[model samples]
Target: MASNDPDREEEAAAAGEDEDTGAQVAPIVTLSEVAVTTGEEEEDALLDLKAKLYRFDKEGNQWKERGTGSVKLLKHRETGKVRLLMRQVKTLKICANHLVLPSVKIQEHAGNDKSCVWHASDFADGELKEEMFCIRFGSVENCKKFMETVEGIAESSEKNEEKESKDASDAAGLLDKLSVHESKTEKAPEEVPAAAVKADDETEK
Candidate 1:
């Protein structure tokens, strides 16, 4: 009976170990990696700063808050085009998106040193619309930096456009000259002599 008791105790210990098993189970679903793309992939970020933006609602007759997020100036790598983009902080939703054109005006908002106002043809809503926007920065320096960078990009864009126009005009003029020279140098088709034509006609008759 004493030997049987020891064997029973050993059996209970083995069952306790099996009940508290530490095994890892495999997951039922396997996930594959997917590539994510943002439209700004082809563009290089020039400036990134945190700011709060507002837009004037003509219908409401008051200023409406657009978003508080990181505003960016993105320049295209190939085309040298610059655009201003701002997204909401929490939701990461775009609030403002427009090109930095020379014709658009950016000025200090009222007497605020940390804020600036600008007019743009915004496309954040997936359509172009004229919008008046004012952005306030946490510091005066950031406000100035954003304004200066925008102005510089605008001037550069204008110059690039002018240079492209001049280059296209020069190319067109060169093509026209080539066409005229070709016309002048081309030989006229050979005409049969009157005597030869008359002899052929007489032989046919």
Candidate 2:
């Protein structure tokens, strides 16, 4: 016995309620968004880039900041929004007077055209370390000078080491030969037989 009009009104009210709630609802995209929505697909291409080696010498005890590498920036395609690209920063403590210097060589896989090196030194007591670090990047020509310098130093050091080793070996051999000669010369002269001396004396008599 319910009236058709009342049933119609109830349905209309339900539709209005749904519309009100829908207008207030806001859609949000969280960080868990899928890669497709992040719009950073192009950035992924650069992710495989090999890190470059940057070298510098630090005094036995000092703190220094190293700035050697590309500064990444994210540019939004549509609005030209630029976001600073985040990178990893590493800090090491100087522990030796003559640091063997760790390998800061950029992997061959890295682009030579895009690579660059930065060198810095910090000294204790607020004095800058007299030592310098050389950073190399870009074209082969860019690194040519530094490479040549390193080669020269290495060659010089190698020559010195070789000369020292040869000198030591030569000195050792001379000492050995001298020792053998002395052993032979140290033998006492053969003693004359008493019988031979008596024979000589008899002959004289």
Candidate 3:
């Protein structure tokens, strides 16, 4: 058993050597993962679907592809307001951001069953601009769903606006009545008291 090869034994000993020196190397710079906010925190997504978005270029007179990603209809929890949001697929960059106002109109794009068009005052690019937008879905059902959801939100927003207007009008009317009553009350003091009038007559007698 002692008749072993020296080279083999040396190689085995080398292989058995612990390569870790037990000294840890510290990183030159440490980076901690920071949380990113998408500004959608206070909203709840009502509808989310995979879709492609487009914008009509007035100068070119043709629709331009915006992005392909998930489009969402987000409703605020407290305000009950809804907005349409679409971000680029990989980048997660917002391509469309606009509120679903009462004036919004979404219709099926001409000759496209799986697509719908709408107009919105978009603020995604940091400036408010009146934009004509079109969105296409993989299925006709998704397209219909997007359109229906948007239009329903618009209708609800319109009703809320109308109700707010009526309430404001009623408040104004009540305030006007109170103001008129105050004016009458102020002028009522100008009329002489009956007892004062009688005392003046007696003094004159």
Candidate 4:
């Protein structure tokens, strides 16, 4: 017969290995710690952010951000275009419920004929009140292209939202109609038996 031993030694060894692995892993991060900025000066910072966000996942480190980072201007840079420097500001450890990107509003610069413009309105920084903080330092082609890309994404999102809302409303209406129909069906009068009616009629005659 084969041995039914518990393999105590092997189990202990495996438990020890698990403890060591856990120690090697870094601690979980809080949401406040993640930040999105206009420009990140070092690649290391970006790497660190990614590690904190995706550590729970099994995938090897990806260069992409766990949150959304959009680049919207006129275009990707023509002959003399300069890219905008953007960064993220995090406040707490990221969880499935919380989005990777912060919720901030931003606007582009408004100039008669200027490229490479930065608009304070494009950013969510509340203290900067004046419109002058915006700038345009990119080429018109690049700015237009960037804006179009962002607009496309926004349009798609809006469409999805609209569709979802419409579906929900339709479902609710159908349910209401069904409920009404069911109530009417249940309240309907029952038919009298023909034999009972005939017997009563003969008795009366």
Q: lDDT per prediction?
A: 0.94, 0.44, 0.92, 0.39
Model 1: what TM-score?
Answer: 0.81
Alpha carbon lDDT at 188, candidate 2: 96
Going through the candidates in the order shown, the clash numbers are 0, 1, 0, 49
TM-score of each: 0.81, 0.33, 0.82, 0.34
lDDT string for model 3 (37-134, tens) is 88999999999999999999999999899999999999999988999999999999889999999999999999999999988899989999999999
Top-down TM-score ranking? 3, 1, 4, 2
Better of 3 and 4 by lDDT: 3
Q: Write the per-residue lDDT of candidate 2 for residues 55-148, one digit (tens) a residue.
A: 3435445434434343232344553332222223343222111211222122222355433442223242245454433333455654554444
lDDT of 1 by residue, 1-205 (tens): 3566878899988998889567888999999999978699999999999999999998999989999999999999998889999999999899999999887788999889999998999999999999999999999999999999998998888898899999999999999999999999999999999999999999999
> Can you write out model 4's per-residue Cα lDDT over 24-141, one digit (the tens) per residue?
6656965566576632232121111111111112254332233322322222222222222233335332211210111112244444333222222222332323222222323555
Instruction: Give candidate 1's total backbone clashes.
Output: 0
lDDT of 1 at 160: 88
By lDDT, the better pick of 1 and 2 is 1
Model 4's C-alpha root-mean-square deviation from the true structure amounts to 21.4
**Stretches > 4 Å off in candidate 4:** 1-85, 88-108, 112-137, 187-205
List the RMSD of every prediction in angstroms: 7.2, 21.4, 5.1, 21.4
Deviation in angstroms for 146 in model 4? 1.3
Candidate 3 TM-score to native:
0.82
CA lDDT, candidate 4, residue 58: 24
